[model samples]
Target: MAGVIQEFKEFAVKGNVVDMAIGIIIGASFTTIVKSLVDDIFMPIVGLLTGGVDFTDFFITLKGAGEYPTLAAARAAGAVTINLGLFINACIAFLIVAWIMFMVVKAMNRLQRKAEAGTADVPPPRQEVLLEEIRDALVRNSTRP
Candidate 1:
């Protein structure tokens, strides 16, 4: 039990694990912001451009025999609906997240490349230089048949 507890502590406190947990928390918050952007901002503009057509009202009623003004109404009426608008909203949010993540990875990769390139000017160890000289001397002596 003590060994298990110690192992758990080590695993939980690892930099990678801690970073992942922080990423997950931030991702959850970002999702909320994205949802609001899609639902409150983008959807409203889209609706206006399409002549006041509320996309959230776009649904297929599979087991109800009436029209619904909104998703809440459909649910309150106990209607079985496949909400296409919600799916569209989710798709938009996913695209936003994916694009942002791609940009972040691109920037990180560029920085990494620059850092690697900067190290190219560094000199090798003296031990390696001496070893190479010895090898060259041996090769020169052997070749003098």
Candidate 2:
């Protein structure tokens, strides 16, 4: 039991675990922000361009007899509907998030490459230099004998 508990503690405290937890929390928050941007900001502009269509209220009633002006009306009247507009909105939000993540990963990769390039030109350690010199001396002495 103690070994299990210790192992759990170690796993919980690992940098990767902590980082993943933070990433999940931040991702949730980012999703909320992106949803708002899609529903509130982008949708409004799109609606204007398309002559004031409300995407959230757009739906096709599959069953029940009567016209529903909006999704809420359809729900209130107990009409089954296929909310294609809502699905479109969700797709747009997903694309926005994907694009932003792609840009972020690209930037990170570029920075990492620059860091690697900077480190590549560094000289070898003094220990390695001394070891190589010793090896060369031994080789020279062996050849003379």
Candidate 3:
């Protein structure tokens, strides 16, 4: 138990674990922002482009209640619905988020490559004095023989 606790403590103190935790927290927050951007900004524009059809309210009730027309009504009456519009909205949001992440990662990779190329520290070629002396001795021996 003590060994396990000590190992956990060491792992927690490591920079990589802390960095990963921070990244996860930031990613969760970023996801909220992305969701808002999609729902508030993009969805409205899309709705306008598609002649003001609201995607959130669009649903096909499997069991039709003739008097209750709205999706909320069908949902309230325990009617099963295929929410295709909401699914489309979700897919669009997912694609947008995926594109944004791709751009961010692409830029990061570009910068990383540039930084690595700029600061490359290849060791200088090696030369051994003893090896040179050995070569010279061989040459001398060959000439004598």
Candidate 4:
């Protein structure tokens, strides 16, 4: 139990875990912003483009009263719905967030590689300079004799 507790403490204290937690919190907040962007801005424009058809109301209730009318109506009546349009909305938001995060991670990796490459020291190749000089001297002496 003590070993487990110590391990947990070590894991929690690691920079990577802390960074991941911070990232998750930021991601959750970012997700809310993205959701609002999709639901409010994008959907309204899309609705106007598509003859004022509200996609959020598009659903197929499995067990409920006649039609259930809208998403709010279905939920208010406690009806189970497929809500495929809402799923599409969620997918759009997820894709947008994922693409943004990919760009960020790619830029970070490129910078990290650049920083590491700049700091790394590459050694020059070695050669027998002293031995070559000694050998040349010995060869000249033997030739003179």
Candidate 5:
């Protein structure tokens, strides 16, 4: 039990574990923002461009005799409906999130490459240069003697 507890403590304190937890929390928050952007902002513009066809109200009745105009009405009438509009909204949100993540990863990769390039161009420290010269001198003297 003590070993298990110690392992758990170690795992909990790890930077990777903490970073993952923070990423998950931020991802969830980002999902909400994306969902809102898709449903509230983009969908409205799409509806306007497509002659006021609201996607949220679009659905097909799977198991019902009465014809319902909207998804909400179909649900209210206890009719089974395939809400394609909601699915479309979800897809749009997913795409937006995916694109943003892709851009972020691309930027990070670019920065990482720049940092690596910069490090490669840096000269060795003066102390290291002097140490190498001393070592070479010692080697030459030892070889002579």
Candidate 6:
């Protein structure tokens, strides 16, 4: 029991675990933003361009009869519906999130490469430089007539 508690403590305090927690929280918030962008902004524009047909209302009635104007009305009428428009909206949101994550990872990789390149440009230690100079002098003297 003591060993399990200690192990749990170690895992909880790890940087990776903390980072993952933060990522999950931020990802939840980003999901809301993406949903709003797709539903409220993008979909409206798309609907306008497509002749003002609200994608949210695009559904196929399976069980209930009679024509309904909107999804809410169909649901209120106890109709069985396949909400393909919601699926389309979800797909758009997923693509947006994917593109954003790709951009973020690309930026981080670029920054990491720059940091590595900067480290590689640092000069050698002064002791190594002096030893190289001494070695060159010795070689010059040995090769002299």
- Output the number of the lDDT-best candidate: 6
- The candidate 5 region of ten consecutive residues with least summed lDDT is 64-73
Tens-digit lDDT string for candidate 1 (59-138): 88888868878888989999999999888888988998899999999999999999999998788899999999999999
| lDDT per residue (tens digit) for residues 65-122 in model 2 | 7998889889888999999999999999999999999999999999999999999998
Supply every candidate's count of residue pairs whose N, Cα or C atoms clash at under 3 angstroms: 0, 0, 0, 0, 0, 0
Instruction: Pick the winner on TM-score between candidates 4 and 6.
Output: 6
Candidate 5 local lDDT, 1-145, one digit each (tens): 9999999999999999999999999999999899889989999999999999999998999998789988888998899988999999989988999999999999999999999999999999999999999999999999994
Q: Kindly list the per-residue Cα lDDT of model 6 for residues 22-105, writing each as its tens digit.
A: 999999999999999999999999999999988999999998989889999999999999999999999999999999999999
TM-score of candidate 3 on Cα atoms, chains taken together: 0.74
Residue pairs with backbone atoms closer than 3 Å in model 5 (clashes): none
TM-score of each: 0.80, 0.83, 0.74, 0.75, 0.87, 0.82
Error of 6 at 29 (Å): 0.7
lDDT (C-alpha) at residue 68 in model 2:
85
| Candidate 1 colliding pairs | none
Task: Give the CA lDDT, 0 to 100, for residue 120 in model 3.
Answer: 88
Q: Write the per-residue lDDT of candidate 4 for residues 32-118, one digit (tens) a residue.
A: 999999999998898899999888998999988777878999999999899988998999898989999999999999999998888
**What is residue 42's positional error in candidate 2, in angstroms?**
0.8
Give candidate 1 misplaced runs (Cα > 4 Å).
Answer: 124-145
Q: Which residue pairs show backbone clashes in model 2?
A: none
Q: List the residue pairs that clash in candidate 6.
A: none
The list of candidate 2 runs beyond 4 A from truth reads 1-5, 125-128, 131-145
Sorted by lDDT, highest first, which candidate order results? Answer: 6, 2, 5, 1, 4, 3
Estimate candidate 6's alpha-carbon lDDT, on a 0 to 1 scale: 0.97
